[model samples]
Target: MASFVMKQMVGGKLNEMKGGLDSLTGGNEGEGEKTETGEDPEVVAARLEQEERRKDKHRKMEQEREKMRQGIRDKYNIQKKDESGGMGGFDMADGRIGAARKKTPEELAAEMHAEDDSLVGQLGLTEHVEKAKTAVNGAFEMVKGFLPFGK
Candidate 1:
């Protein structure tokens, strides 16, 4: 009878060990942590600030893109022709905005690559525009000097 009791206790101990090993090896990521959703206030505040900073940066980027697009439109003399344009947003144009045809994926991708700098809101464009204008104007002046008979 004593031997039988000892055998039962040994078997129970072995079962508990097996169960513990199984849990340690293969289980959900946060299986037994206390209060998984609970976070410190400081951590939450920091996270929020980080998110706001990210959003602000994104907004600034979006604004820069708008400025570049506007610059291009002004360069090409596009204007707002219609008061209403239903669903597709703005009835505006950089110049008589053409038909609303969408570009294929490949075409769009190519266009995007060309406009990469504009999207990133780079500062080099202002210098580029100024230099180009000066060069062209200087060339015109030189040509005018050569054409003394006309002026």
Candidate 2:
């Protein structure tokens, strides 16, 4: 009984699909009606011309927008991605093109160390840090001299 109901449902669906396919194939229906390919040549030409004009108007608008963007960039000294060459417009102080390619672990570590050194130098703490290290070393030596354990 279930199989019979399923067969009925499938038969109904097949009929609907056949009807749809017949309409799409223009089979024996609307034989006198004008299809797109059967339309007048002048109408097709005017449609194509209108489409070209619309496309040209959009192109002009896009050009105007680009000009405005360029003017703003020039006024504020902004750089485009292509103009900056993927470096995001920031140049390394050491004149290295760091962003041109991927960096190894060693290279990344060296860059971090250099950045730390530069930050210390910029803050005027390099000399103070050096003096502190010297003082600590001297104190350690004095304590070692008084102790007889290592002798």
Candidate 3:
């Protein structure tokens, strides 16, 4: 008996929620509140304006992101594939965005070699300096051992 009462209460609440949603959405499944045959001119204009604003926002964001990516590429000495004689090298200039191309194995290898050589030169010099310091320290210890001194 309690379960039956609970079910009826739940069903009534669900119906009320559905009615609220329908009212918010202009009540009809296939048509809005204006009419069955045509849309309001003002509503249409508003929707178009909204869409234009959305596109503008998206374009601005993409331009900002591209600028940051360009800066990073410049700092790392990464070559832009779009630098060839063609205007559409990496990104096309025709206002159409395209996916980035995957780099070739050879290109990857070359970049890796360049980066590795720089790292090796830096680290190798540091390691040699540390070894020289250790040798000096050891020589100082030997000299102190021979000195006639007391603590």
Alpha carbon lDDT of residue 143, candidate 3? Answer: 87
Tell me how many clashing residue pairs each candidate has: 2, 0, 1
List lDDT for all candidates, in order: 0.74, 0.82, 0.77
As for candidate 2, its clashing pairs are none
Please give the lDDT score for candidate 3. 0.77
Q: Which ten residues in a row have the lowest lDDT in candidate 1?
A: 86-95
Put down candidate 1 lDDT per residue, 30-50, tens digits, no spaces: 445434467655667888999
Give per-residue CA lDDT, model 3, range 1-69, as digits (tens): 999999999999999999999989876754554644488666887999999999999999999998998
Error of 1 at 70 (Å): 0.4
Measured with C-alpha atoms, the lDDT of residue 145 in candidate 3 is 85
Question: For this target, which candidate reaches the highest lDDT against the unseen true structure?
Answer: 2
TM-score of 3: 0.33
